[model samples]
Target: MSSLDGTVAAPLSPPRPSSRLPRASDQDGSYPRPQMLRGAWADLDGTWSFRNTGDDPAWRTGFPDARDIVVPFPPESPASGIDEPGFHPVVWYARTITRAELDAAGYGGAAPRLLLHFGAVDHRARVWVDGQFIGEHEGGHTPFTLDVTEALGTDPDTAHTLVVRAEDDPHDVTQPRGKQDWHEHPHAIWYRRTTGIWQTVWLEAVPTASIAGLRWTNVDHATMRLTVRLSGERPAGARVRITARWHEGDEDLATVEAVVPVHAHEVEVVVPVARQQNGQAEDELVWSPETPRLVDAVVSLLPAEGPEPLDAVSSYFGVRTVGVDGGAFLLNGRAYDVRSVLNQGYWPESHLAAPSRQALRREVELIKELGFTAARNHQKIEDPRFLYWADRLGLLVWGEAPGAYAFSPLAVQRLVREWMDAVERDASHPSIVTWVPANESWGVQHVATDPAQQAYARSLADVTRALDPTRPVISNDGWEHTNSDIVTVHDYEGDGARLATTYADDAARTALLGGRGPADRRILVGGAVDEGQPVMLTEFGGVDFQPGAKREDGWGYTSAVDDDDWVARITALYDGVRASAFLAGSCWTQLTDTVQETNGLLNADRTPKVPIERIRAAVTGR
Candidate 1:
């Protein structure tokens, strides 16, 4: 067959065996969706037939070239085997799913329906199974699924060809691109682009009537709320059963079942914690960076009269709450000094895609070892697997959305849709303590003056709260805030005494409250006034220091002469931040040194530029 672009379609070749197979056990931390786990699933992270289609739409039906690329890694990354730095707006991927693979994933077992899940695909993606169009999705940073059972036909022995088409315009500034650069070359804060398939792709088998989604809400210290959404057939008199247990023990802490009405597709039930029933202190069961306790849960769908569940999935959550009280950032109703580091979530080898699942777990451990309780995932909707590690390992996270450079109606629509999806996808994770929708006025550039931009900024915060009100929403993270739950400022001043004087006492409060602050931008906009929101120095202390490298080779807010100088500079910065009596929390500029940004506490390869102990002490001031 010949493609419409005057090119003969190449014969589909067998998928090359991937050296990086999915981890065998969920306990080993290879499961892509950590919060929700099903026994019957197959990892699709492997080799695939790849082709750069450029701007040609003709390649959607068939590709004319034969190439190989690794799944879940963008082509711009060295790990993908096609480390092309230049822009290729359109790309295609193809792989064959054999009957053996399907059978191993339980396709003909208890669960018959087959669901193909993509953890994330950049910009836009369209899926086809055996030449039949299955579905399409937009927004690069969130997951989407397609039921391909019918597309694969009823034959259990049949093999199916799965194809994906991704379109990511590098010059399209209206999209929520985050730190992905629009130019051909990386510069300043922006790095290389992640065009397509930067996260996991997997397959799962489920019954016709199955659990589609699960959400856990910490209703109170003593109560937890579970919301279940069903898929396919919603039989009348169906029931959803929920059983929650402590992570360590086999004893069921709470069990609750709710009946689904004839037409109801969703149901919510409250599960009471037994440990906190008798006026016991909520500390034992509550989740925090110190304790890091988790409650594992199994959600099942049952017919009105059946002894067997139609479908089941395992999940986990923590009983915790985050809020701002006066000048304190409260966690579980108690004041907590948030020590956070800005994590860009990029790797030298894999770009936005993590090098491996184990790397994600180590990232969390490294953050904790550095003495920071929280990580602000700056300008990226991180992989859910990373959030799983954070949930298990007890590191707080601030969920943020990628920002668009240009502001337009399309930009507003794209950003809102993606940001909402990001929140809804991660809302169940216990690690996420805050939602940052905009940073430094990236999309809403005129928010400080323009009424429309201000409304947009306010709406982002408002809509995020509407979805998940448990976490505080920073409307604009850095500056030019409107309707923000926390008043956050971004200042890179290096001098310790000067930084202290700038943020001290009533003078700083007056300046910040009156729409003036360190960044020389308005702290409040759209006539919004500070309503006693907890003020935090959210961004500061970007001291560039790369051992055995020239200072001019990399960039940061400030430069350090050597390792000792780096320690002294960071310690002074922390001291200055601590000097501010009204500050509720602080987040340093970065966790790792990115490609050209060498101001990280650790090097890009997860190596500490200075001793880990010194970095911890500087970060914690202890």
Candidate 2:
């Protein structure tokens, strides 16, 4: 079967679906890590014993009051079956890992290693296997893994007990909480808090020495750089084999093999793509919101004297480049208008945790249905599954880190570490074109004046660039920018005329860019000059309209009386934005109505307030 680009390969079997919208069972029980897929794995996402330990540490031994709760759903959400919205600083979870499950995960091998993986656990997580401490992780949003071969013991008939203790201080202002309200009740922009396990947890079995990490870098139109990181012992005379095939058509792109040097654990290989050769037009295979062409790859670590490989993983990548050229955001060496929406990534039933894997794919479909080319994942590092869907379905994304409320040394340490982790975890995705480390100076509240805070904000951008130079980094998104590739503003002007007047022409735009516009905040600070960076109205058009019932606590930047009124208001706002010659892109206020925020294009149940076509017309200005 041929893909959209008329390419096919053995790995591209079942062919890319022709429909824009995914099937109902598309991602049900699908591999969580689509980028790096292994055949030997187990899905440990069902029922689990849960208990809120409060402030007591005694629950480490055993849960006194245990109840059945759904895995990967926070207790604050109804899907978890422990709908306790109130604060619980510590939570304990217990489950059994049977030998049969290990066997199902292809466990029986010479010197096999059983590995445990957690998608994410809020704040801090400590793990134990049969009363033996395995390891711990600090970041709440990033994934962590541990080799539990010793923890599982040598007994094939044994059923190991796995336990996790997650500690998240609800009132910890220094933590990167994002939209999770520190308050007991949901208020303003903050929503209910997600405590304990909120993402996938699973197990896998591999050889003693395996592929630890894989990074794909698009060097240019034709050249692709592959970085492979090894785990465990670096055996002598081991060679890494990499094979690339066209995702759509049955075509061999590249095949290269490099031997691991003794005492070294990393190797870099260059894969020259056939279609993207210098003579051919690069746009044919380049990835963008319009056409996302991926190259499927199989990487294997082969040992010295054996025909079998020590480890093999399936991965894919797209040939694309993103940068700010002059005053425009360029994708694939061409100017690209970023018509985006603020995606808070919340669901009515699961809070931060997606209700199901299929829901993540549907979210991407819904975003595209609204005629958005991009999504600014506001104040959240969304699940990897969502990013996979975006990559496959051809949607650009702005990766933003959750913000901390206060400024302190600990806050700086926490934000920098977690933000770097978030970037590293998602840097390989072709969909993420930009990195937003700080939003509206959430952690650096005094960045406009305080040199210390300003320095912190600058460091975030600098460090992000250092880690992943492929994408542009926004030091502080919204306003009060210290160092940013794009000048992004957050204007919640209720009047469309006022918004139009504010960014009418060069004089008005220069004045606003030099000084403050809406939100009563500086666009640039710390003696920074506007060097013709691409200007984008990243946040606007938050017109709230509830068709039927409305919550008393629901609020928005502006209110609409009816569906027609809402359509008129948003259409006028989009027109106002389109009138601005200086603005390169615009992101609507939000994609869905979150908790107390009633200014979403869709309702809490993922239903459009008005006809989707009307909203699309308003958004696309067509």
lDDT of 1 by residue, 1-622 (tens): 2211112233222112111222111246788787777776788888998988454555545566758999889999899999998997888998888887797677876678899999999989999988888999999999999998888777778788888999999999999999999989889889999989999888988888888888888777677788888888787777776544463454444333333332478788677665565545567678899988887666667777753567767777888888888778899889999999999999989999999998999999999999999999999999888888888889999999999988898999999999988988999998999999999999888888898888888888999999998889999998888888899999999998889987888677877679577768988888888788899899999999979948565989999988889999999999999999788889998999998899999999999997899999887888
User: lDDT per prediction?
Assistant: 0.83, 0.83
State the weakest 10-residue window (summed lDDT) of model 2: 12-21
TM-score of each: 0.93, 0.94
Model 1, residue 159: C-alpha shift (Å): 1.8
Clashing pairs in 1: none
